[model samples]
Target: MAAAPPPPSCCLVALPPHAKDGLVVFGKNSARPRDEVQEVVYFPAADHEPESKVECTYISVDQVPKTHAIVISRPAWLWGAEMGANDQG
Candidate 1:
């Protein structure tokens, strides 16, 4: 028998100062025509006040023959971090 293929890598998105309160994660599956997965995670403020930086990690268990991508968006108050697979994968 053949060994099972390794799981696909995970996708991560970082949020800059401001929009740290709300974080939404979007994922796409191979069979689905559109995004079939949606997740939301809330991170507490660092010191009672609103957080300025936030980072999130998303992993896909539903393996597909096609590539997997993650989309992240937030309010104008927040910004995105400049990271790559090397940061976490």
Candidate 2:
């Protein structure tokens, strides 16, 4: 028998008048191979206290004196964001 088709990856955005708030929606289907590994991570807010540093990479830079919280979904062995969203206001 022939193999079945894969599911579709989709995203939806609802927009109204500029005076009103809108909504955003995302849905990922069977886009990646089943053997691959992905992880969803949550980063809490720093509140701009002693400042945040960039130690997650191979380079060094200035500290972030101000920042917000965020969540990212990326590869299991890499520090990259394939999909991410912020929880800030």
Candidate 3:
């Protein structure tokens, strides 16, 4: 079988520290249509189930000041996330 194609290319920017009005903002643009992009929240945690084989590469609960809410942009057709920010910031 042929391999699945990669998702659309995207550009992301985290606003500078000196952003106007002192607001911290993140922006992203992707070649995918707006209809296929979505906003979601993930409560990240380790998969401790013995039978499960998935591993999380991002933050683990024990490795931070504390875990916080994760707000993210997700692609409708893929399990991978596009971009996100935590409540910590």
Candidate 4:
């Protein structure tokens, strides 16, 4: 039988406002199948599809900048993103 995937791990650190050209770095390792790994982009948008606005279902339109950009690491078998970072950071 195949082995189970490893649990997730994450870390976040805040940078000083004066910091320039700073690098936001983190390491992630997953034992999931290679075919399931995928890179995805999450552009902030409104959640108008649902009849009733679900609480915390998505990022609010106002919270996102006009040029906001987000890059995410996702697993194809999962319904949501595993981790991501935004340009503003």
Candidate 5:
């Protein structure tokens, strides 16, 4: 059988404002630890559908702060939708 994907690490940390809501933060990993930033956003549930009102937005790493902590907001929700860690679907 093929190997299963590894469980997510505990290093995930969400930022202050949205942390209490279960948001997670992610950064780049290098040979030595260094700070890198990226942002992936999700719209309201109703907007997820093709004809929904919500507009999906993808903010590239260059748009956000390099050291700023991003809010993953809903990891399980993303996974449930079949969107892997690096996927935004």
Candidate 6:
């Protein structure tokens, strides 16, 4: 069976501009599908490296920019993210 589509909303909670300390604490907890496994992958920032190919879930783009480093957890068979942490944080 195919997966269901996402709900029609941005996932953030909407709050009035004047609301202060209304929702300072937030967290997430989710379970991976039983058929899938995930692993951690890191992409280092290389501003002056030769142009190369990047393989994504559906297609291969000929040139992709890697100006900022990132660490991501992803499925072993796919070339995308399950969760990611950027270089800054």
Q: What lDDT would candidate 6 get against the real structure?
A: 0.66
Per-candidate TM vs. native? 0.16, 0.56, 0.45, 0.42, 0.17, 0.52
TM-score: which is higher, 5 or 6?
6
Candidate ranking under TM-score, highest first, comes to 2, 6, 3, 4, 5, 1
Q: So what's the TM-score on candidate 6?
A: 0.52
Off by over 4 Å in 1: 1-33, 47-89
> Mind giving the per-residue lDDT tens digits that candidate 1 earns over 20-84?
65653334232222433333323222232233322334332332333323334333223432221
TM-score-better candidate, 1 vs 5:
5
* Model 2 poorest ten-residue lDDT run: 10-19
In candidate 5, what are the lDDT values of residues 1-89, reduced to their tens digit? Answer: 99988644333446767667655665432232224232345433221333333223432222222222223433332222222243332
Ten contiguous residues with the weakest lDDT in model 5: 60-69
- The true-versus-predicted C-alpha distance at residue 48 of model 1, in Å, is 12
> Each candidate: what lDDT?
0.34, 0.66, 0.60, 0.57, 0.36, 0.66
The TM-score of predicted model 4 comes to 0.42
- Per residue, candidate 6 scores C-alpha lDDT tens digits across 3-48 of 9886542233335553476543322333556578778788998764
- Please give the lDDT score for candidate 2: 0.66
Best by TM-score: 2
Off by more than 4 A, model 6: 1-28, 48-51
Considering summed lDDT, which 10 consecutive residues are worst modelled in model 4?
Answer: 57-66
Runs in model 2 lying further than 4 Å from the true structure: 1-23, 29-33, 47-52
Assess the local accuracy of residue 12 in candidate 5 as a C-alpha lDDT between 0 and 100: 49
In model 6, how large is the Cα lDDT of residue 81? 78
